[model samples]
Every structure is written in C-alpha cells, then in structure tokens.
Target chain A: MNAKEIIARRVARELKNGDVVNLGIGLPTLIPNFLPSGITIIVQSENGFLGLGPLCDEPNPSLVNAGGEPCGIVAGAAFFDSAMSFALIRGGHVDVSVLGALQVDSLGNLANWMVPGKRVPGMGGAMDLTTGARHVIIAMEHCTKDGSAKILTNCTLPLTCSGKVQTIVTEMALFRINNGLVLEELCPGVSIADVRNCTEADFTVSPNCIATPGELI
Target chain B: MNKCMSLHEVKAVFRDGMTIMCGGFLGVGSPEGLVRELMSNGAKNLTLISNDSAFPDSGIGQLIANKRVTRLIASHIGTNPETGRQMIAKELEVILVPQGTLAERIRCGGAGLGGVLTETGVGTLVEEGKIKLTANSIKYLVELPLRADIALIKAKRADRAGNLVYEKAGRNFNPLMALAADLVIVEVDELVDCGEIDPETVITPGVVIDKIVVSGGY
Candidate 1:
C-alpha cells in the first residue's frame, strides 16, 4: 500500500461499529474507503449530511460534502440545516472526528488551517469538530515535503485546536497522547530508530509498542 | 396572505448596499432566480452572508465575480479564486467566521439572543478580538448574533401561504436564514395551494416569509 493508504487504513481501525464519525477534508476523507465491511458507522459532513456514503463517480453538483467534494448518500441519511448540523456536533452527539494536520505538538495541539503569510483558504469547521467531538484522531504524513518533522515539540504554524488531539496515526508510527507523547505502535517496515530520526517531538516508547498487525498494513 | 409573486415584482426590494443573507452550500439550496434577477438589476456595494462564496460562475460567487459585492461575511472563500484576488487587492472586505459559530450567530439573531458562549477558539487566531468569559472554570468566547436586511432562499415546495419544504441537503441554511432576516424571499420549484402540504413536513412557516417566486417546476 502507499503511505497515505497505510495511514488511512490505520486510522480506520480506530473507529467502532455504530460510531457517528465526522471525517475532515484530506487524509481523513480516505478512511471511509478503507473501513472493513460489516462495520457500519454513520459518517457526517458539516455541510449538513449525517449519513455519508462513498464518493460519487457520477457527478451530482447538488450532493457534496463539507469539502465540496461530490459524494453519495447512505440509505437512511438525514438532511439538516447548518444550525442543526452544528448542533449535532457542538451538542456532543458525534462520536469521533478524524482530521488531517499540518503539525501536532507534544501537548496534542493541531495546526491545519493556515500557514501564516500565505493566503490559505479560511477555516471551515475544523475548530468546532476538534473541540466538540467526544474523540479526535489525527491522520497525516510524518514529515513536510522538505523532510521537516510535523510531530513537533511545539507547533509553529497557527493552531486549529488547543491540545484536543487524542490519537495520531502517521505513515511511520502511531502515537497516543497521555501525560505526554507515547509511542504505541510502529508501521511494519519502520523501526524505533527510524521514528527517532524523523520525529522531532520527544516520546516514551510503550512496552507494548510493536509492529502494526499484518491485515492492517 | 397571497405571497406568490413574479421575479420582476421582487426586484424592487433590492437596493445598493443592502445586507443580504442567502441560503446554500455552494449552489445546492440557493435562490438562483432571485440571484439572477439581482445580478441583472445591477445592485452594487452589497454585503453577502452565507456558508461559502461558491465557485466563480455559481451561486453568490457570480456577484463577487461581477464586482457587485463590496463585503462578504462567510466561513470560507477558497472555492472562488476571484474572492481571494479581490481580498488581497483590497477591493472587497471579507470576515471569516468558524462555520458552527457562524450558524449559531445567525440562529441567535433569529432567536433574539445577544450572543453565545463557547470554547471553540480558545487559543487560536479566532480568539483575537473577542470577549473571553469563564464559567465553571472553563473559558469561552462570546460570539455576537448576526442579522440581515433580507434573506434569499430556495425550497423544494411552497404553498400560497408560503409554508416551505426542502429537498435533501439543499436545506442547509434556508430555515435558519428565514428566521434571521427582516424580509425573507423564497424561490421554489413547486407551488401549491394552502393545506396541500402536510403540517409535519413544513420547514419554514408562512408567517416569516415576505415574498415567494415560482421557478421552473421540479
């Protein structure tokens, strides 16, 4: 599998049956494709859909996700307005939120929206999703295009949320936030030393930190 | 009250510099006929409030592209490159609100509340110029309500009395916007006589709607 697919597959394992999950725009949007069959989870889009299906091959401009990407609707999907859709989120009805991140600090703060001087698109619903969901999972690449680590001691980029991340799934390793960053699992081909070489944040290796399961990789 | 009218009769309500709210996510539930009428009528220096600016050729983006809008209050504008260009060139003023907060602000305006308290943006750049209050040992930002002079919306069906129903995700902001505007204008694909629609399915009641225009039937 490619690096993005690997990370997406790992993130999919974090979901449970019957979970009402919100998938963010980038890497998180890929999790639905990798989720194992027989595990039914209601997918939500902040653009006012509660039960989201796969991306539509036939383009229907009217049916779109929060990212403005074309998508199909599930059998029992409910339509709502922006206020009621957000009420589902802010009212703590959503089970989990998986989002992409530009940087994640030791304290689990996420920076995904803007890059300072650049004229990036405005924040859509990232702030509310990260804050309101019962659980927040981050899926992203290990490093920047220039090989700079995205797992940092502190995020230099603007933050989307302040220390709300619960788990992070990257191509190299899986990290969970406790008192600080704790290394939980490594990808099949990657080693602890390899993680150390690429990751800038300091982390403690859990005794159970082992290779990812074969089926997931 | 007979609220049904032609697109031509509705044009008189729009003027330059009016603050207008439109209901849609991109163009899904937007009032296309009213938007086209406003465009042809040449309203200028207007402030638009909605979810996004949509694409340059679609929905409210058409106004932004025609240079008729002077200010925009919405969540995101990336879908329209022209909006970014105008923003950078100082031709248009844009105020970006968090999507949920934007929804709540409009809802509060309709509900007659002063503001809402939430911790959505405690430490981010969104916290910059807002009042912070602490309750039960947690900090929250005070988001003020937002109201508009007029709201343009689209619906699946409307009766002569103006009770409306929407189809699928097209209901995005129409109902909430209906309650927040001083005058609400709805464009519908189907129009029927009163008592034809089931009371349970009515999304926006006739009391809040000021005008209704029948578009091509669905």
Candidate 2:
C-alpha cells in the first residue's frame, strides 16, 4: 500500500464521529484526508484557530493567528486568542491528538520537543495537549538516521508528554501501550521474529493480537 | 559604544533576497537595525520566515509596509494585515506549517536533524495533496527543516566581545534562531564593555555571532 494511504487508513480506523482532533504536522496532517467521509473532526490549533482547513488563497491578515505560519484556512474555523486556544486543550475539549515524537519509551514517554545536550528553545503546546487530550497517538518513524530505534527502553531526552501515548504506528508494525510496554499486532505476513529483529526494544506479541486491520478495530 | 554602526552598514552584509529567519514572536526583541536595513535597501523577492508577522508600523509589519518581502513561511501571519492582503491577491506566497512543527523545523534545521514526521494534519485539508512518508511501522507527515542564509536577532544587551541576553518576550524565538542560522546578525539595545555581562546570563555566544550592530536608545 502507498505510505500515505496505509497511515491514513490505519489511523482512520481509530476515529469515531464528533472526535475533536489535533494534528501536529507532517504525517499527522495527512490524517484528515483518510478520515471516513461522514465524520466531521473539529480541528484546534494552539495559535487560536479551530476547524482549520488547508492552505488557500486569501489575503485577509486578520485571518492569521499567532502561529505566524501561512495555511489554507478551512471554512468556519472559529478564531480566538492563545488563552482561549489553550483552554480547549487544558480543559480537555480535545478528544485526540496525533503528535510526532523524536523518541518514545516503553512507558509511553515522548521526547518530541528537544534532543539532549542542545539548548532547547521551548515547548510550545505539546505539554498542554499531552495532558489534556483523551487519547494521544504518536506518529513517527521507527528509527533515527543513525539507526537508533526511537522506540526505546527509556527516553534519554526531555519529555513533551509523559506516559500518555495510547498507540504508536510505524510502517512496519502497530503497537499499543499495554502494561508499560508496547504490545504488537502482527500484519498479514509479519511474524514475532520479524518485529523483534526490526525493533530495538523487547516486546511481546499480544496473544489476542489480530492479523488483519479490521479484526481489532 | 564603539560597537555601534549605521543601519546601512548592518544591512550591507545581510542583503536583500536572502532567506532570513527572524526572532520575535510578535514585535518582541526583534533586531531593529537589521529590519530597518532590509526595509531601506528596498530588496525584493525576499522569502522572510519568522514565528509571526510583526504588527503594522512595527516589527516585521514595517517590512510589509515597505513591501519588501515576496514569500513567507511561517506558523502565524495574524499580526500583520498588509502581508495578508498580499497573500490573498497572490502577490506573495505563504507556506503555512503547524506552530510547534514550525519551531521544530527551525530547531531541526539548526540541529542537523532530517525532516520531522508527525500526525497533526492527518485526514484534513492540511494533508491535501502532500507527500506522506512512512518509516518502520509508523507513518509521519514529513516536514522539512528551514535554515536561513542569514538570521537577524534581537537581544537586550551585549558585552564588548558580544554575549547576548534577552528581555521578557524578546527572549522568545530569537535565541533559538541564532543557533540555527549560518550567519547570525545580532541587534542589541545596549552594548556594554567586554566582561561587563555575567557569563551565566549570556544566551548566545560571540563565536556564533558574525556581526553585532548596536541600536539607538529606545
């Protein structure tokens, strides 16, 4: 399957109607394309725009927000100030948040904001979303360029969200946060040995794991 | 004192049409001299990238008032209304990324990290017609790093040798972009003698800084 389709399809399976979601950026942004046609996800941005659409051609400066980034605005995205935007996150108005992580641990600790030994600028809003969102899903690669598995025994970097990730999806496997370790679900041709050799951290294939996508969700 | 230079001299090295990543969330600790230079130079076709467009008659909005920039890649453009008009009429090009991801791209550009992948815009127009890359078993939205040829930064004060410290909101994004740019041009409110500033308070080192242009009394 195409990379985008696989991710969108898999992630869409987790969604239901009226779920307010936040997509971080990158692959997570693509999730909107794969959502079921009937579902309407109320998107919230920390910079104070909600129901945001894709980039479009409009010059209204007042339509912009604090994020200072150009985007195609969706129809009817309620705009507000940072205080109101964060209130939604901190108040738990967000049902789910799909975030990108630099590193994740068996304990579901996420280090998405900074790497160790570098002067970290700041954690913008990940801290708020992690603590506020009902379900936190991590969308990232399985390893770093140095071949270091981001799925670690423990994260060595700063925590953006601690022990909050419910599901972690990669190209090779889909793992759920179970009992403080990632429990694996085998794909059509994938085996426990295949998952073990590919991942740096030790994991167990859930005895109740499903082979096909529809079986679990 | 001796470190002070005219706005023309400051703009000389940081020329027009260059990719400049400016610090300042919104008119907060932005390098005034460098911004004024970019304005007076009348440089066109600029791809100005920052956290937010500055307010009208102030910050990056002043640049917009001068009509200098041609493109912008930012997280928010709300602060400046003029730039928004240019964008709407197709006079300017704007590439909008998520806020946290925008900062991370600059951070990643500074840290030599390849593009980051996330799920922020999944299943929305934000993902419409964009490339989706998957690695390992997970999927990610691939956001490339953004590094400027020149970085114009604002600081509260600098010692003779050029160590910087920023005031409240001025401290926001300036320090981070300083480390990420190839040539970091610092604009300081006050220039003290060498060794005058405490070592611990220094946010940006002199070595990373290429030029220190002093600002007028504000």
Candidate 3:
C-alpha cells in the first residue's frame, strides 16, 4: 500500500461500530474504504447531511459535500439545513472527525486552515470538527514533500485549534495526545528512529506502546 | 398571499449594494437562475453570505467573476480561486467564518436572537476580535447574528403558499437563509398547490417567505 493508504488504513482502527464519522477532504477521505468488515459507521458531510457514501459515478450538481465535491449517500441517510447539520457536530454528537493537517505540535495544536502570505482558503468546518467532535484524529503525511517534519515542537503557522487534537496518524507511526504526543504504534517495518528522524515534535516512546496495524481491531 | 412572481419581478427586488444570503454549499443548493438574474440586473457591490463562493464558473462565482460582489461572508472559498485572488488583491472583503458558526449566526438572526456562543475557533484566529465569555469553566466565542437584505434560496418543491421542500444535500443553508433575510425569495424547481406538499416535510413555512420564482434555465 502507498503511504496515504497506510495512514488511512491505520486510522480506521480509531473508529468503532456505530460511529458518526466526518472525514476531511484529502488523506482522511481514504479511511472509510479501509474499515474492518461488518463495522458500520455513518459518515457525515459537513454541507448538510449524514450517511455520506462514496463519490458518485454520476453526481448531482446540487448534492455535493462540504468540499464542493460530488458524493453519494446510504439508504438510511438524513438531510437537514446547515444550522441543524452543524448543531449535530457542535453539540458533540459526532463520534469522530478524521482530518488532514498541515502541522501538529507536541501540545496537539493544529495548524491546517491557511498559510500566511499565501492566498487564504477559508476555514470551512475544520475548526468546528477539531473543537466539537468527541475525538479528533489528524491523518496526514509524516513529512512535507521535501521531507521536513510536520510534527513540530510548536506550529509556526496560524492554528486552527489549540490543544484539541487527540490522535495523530502518519505513515510511520500513530501518536496519542495525552498531555503530550505519546508514540504508541508503529507501522510494519517502521522503527522508532524513523519517526524521530522525521518528527520535530518532542514525543516520548510509550513503554508498552509499540504495536503494528490490525492490533487496534 | 400571492407570493409567486416572475423572474423579472424578482430582479426588481434587488438593488445595487444589497446584502444577499444565498443558500448553497459550493454552488449546490444555490439559486443559480436567481444569481444569474442578479448578474444581469447589474447589482454591484453586493454582499454575499453563503457556505462558499463556489467554483469560478458557477453560482455566485459568476457574480464574483463579474465583480458584482464586494464583500463575501462565508465558511469556505477555496473551491473558487477567483475569490482568493480578489481577497488577496483587496478587491473583496472576505470574512471567513467556521461553517457551523456561520450557520448558527444566521439562525440566530432569523430567530431574533442576540448572538451565538460557540466553542469553535475559540483559540484560533477567529477569536482575535470577538468577545470571549466563560460559563461554568467553558470558554466560547460570541458570534453576532448575520442577516441579509434579501435571501435567494433554491428549493426542490414549493407550494403556492411558499412552503418549501429541499432536495437531499441541496438544502444546506437555504432554510436558514430564508429565516434570516429581510425578503425571502425562493426559486423552486417544482411549484405545487398549497396542499400538495405534506406539512411535515415543509422545511420552511410560507409565513416567512416574501417572493417565489420559478426555477429558471441557466
């Protein structure tokens, strides 16, 4: 599997049965395909609906997701206006929100909304998802394209939310944020040094936390 | 209560520099024909409140592309690069609110509430100028209500009485905008009789609607 697929595959383990999950547009969008068999979760599109299915082969123009992407819905889907839709998210009814992040600090601060000096793409529901979801999981690449660390000691860019991320999933490892980022799991063939070499964030290795994928399930 | 009107009559309701609440998330559920009419109506310096500025070629994107909108209050504008360009150039005043907060603010406006308190964007830049309040040790940003001069909403079905039913996800910000605007103008794909639409499914009651337009071809 590719790096993103590996990251998404591992992130799916963070979910449980009957979870109302909201996946951000990018790497996190790949997670639902990797869920364990017989596990049923209702996916949410921030636009205005629950039970978001896969991308439709022929998508209707008026039925797009929050990212303005065309998507499908399950049979038991429910639709509402944006106000009520977000009430579900902000009311802490969503079980999980898996989002792609640009930067994550040791303190679990997230910076994904915009890069200063670059054209500002508006923050959609990410800030809410980071704040309102019961569990916020950031699923992203371990490093930048040039191979620099994204897990930093402190996020230099503007933060989307401060100290709200609970879990961080990367190609190399999975870190749980409990006061600080705790290195809990490693993907197959990934060593502790591999994560350390790429991460700028100060993280401590868990005493008995070294495990591989499929362990969570 | 004859709420139905011709597209031209709907166009007459718009004036230059009007604040419009357009219901849509990324052009879906947006009042496309009404937006197109607003374009030809030559209403400039418009303020658009919606979920997004959509792609450069569609919905409010056309208005933005034509330089009709001077300010945009929305949750996301990444799908429309033109909006980004204009915002960077300082030609457009863009207020990017979190999606849920934006909805709640609009809801508060229509419901005649003072403001909405939310935990979203509490520690982020969204809190920079806003007043923060704490209750029971929980912090929240108090977002003010956002109301528009007119609301351009698209619905799948509407009775002559102006009761509305929206399509699947096409209903994003429509019902909220309908409630928050001074004049609610709905463009319906199918216009039915007063009793045709079931009461339970009518998302927006006719009492608040001011005008209704038949869905126009783009």
Question: Which stretches of model 2 miss by more than 4 angstroms?
Answer: A1-217, B1-5, B128-131, B134-138
Quote the TM-score that chain A achieves in each candidate.
Answer: 0.96, 0.86, 0.95
Across B21-56, the per-residue lDDT of candidate 2 in tens digits comes to 888766656776678777877777778888767687
lDDT of 3 by residue, A1-217 (tens): 7999888888887789999999998888888898989888999888888998886578887677666678888889999888888889989999999888889998989998898658578789999888889999999999999998999989998999999889999888999999888999888788898889999988999997876745542
Regions more than 4 Å wrong, model 1: A55-61, B216-218
Off by over 4 Å in 3: A55-58, A214-217
Candidate structures ordered by DockQ, highest first: 3, 1, 2
lDDT of 2 by residue, A1-217 (tens): 6544566566766778878888775677778777777977877766556876665786443333234445556667664434346567756789998887888888877887544333332345676577668998887766676867888888877677567788987655789887766565555676767667667677766777766475332
Between 1 and 2, whose DockQ is larger? 1
- Interface root-mean-square deviation, each candidate: 1.3, 12.9, 1.0
Alpha-carbon deviation at A16 in model 2, angstroms: 27
What would the TM-score be for candidate 1 when compared with the true structure? 0.95
Give a tens-digit lDDT track for model 3, residues B5-75.
Answer: 88877678789888999988877888888988898889898998988898899988989888999999998
Q: Predicted chain A of model 3: TM-score relative to the true chain A?
A: 0.95
- Model 2 CAPRI rating: incorrect
DockQ of each: 0.74, 0.03, 0.85
DockQ, computed on Cα atoms, for candidate 1: 0.74
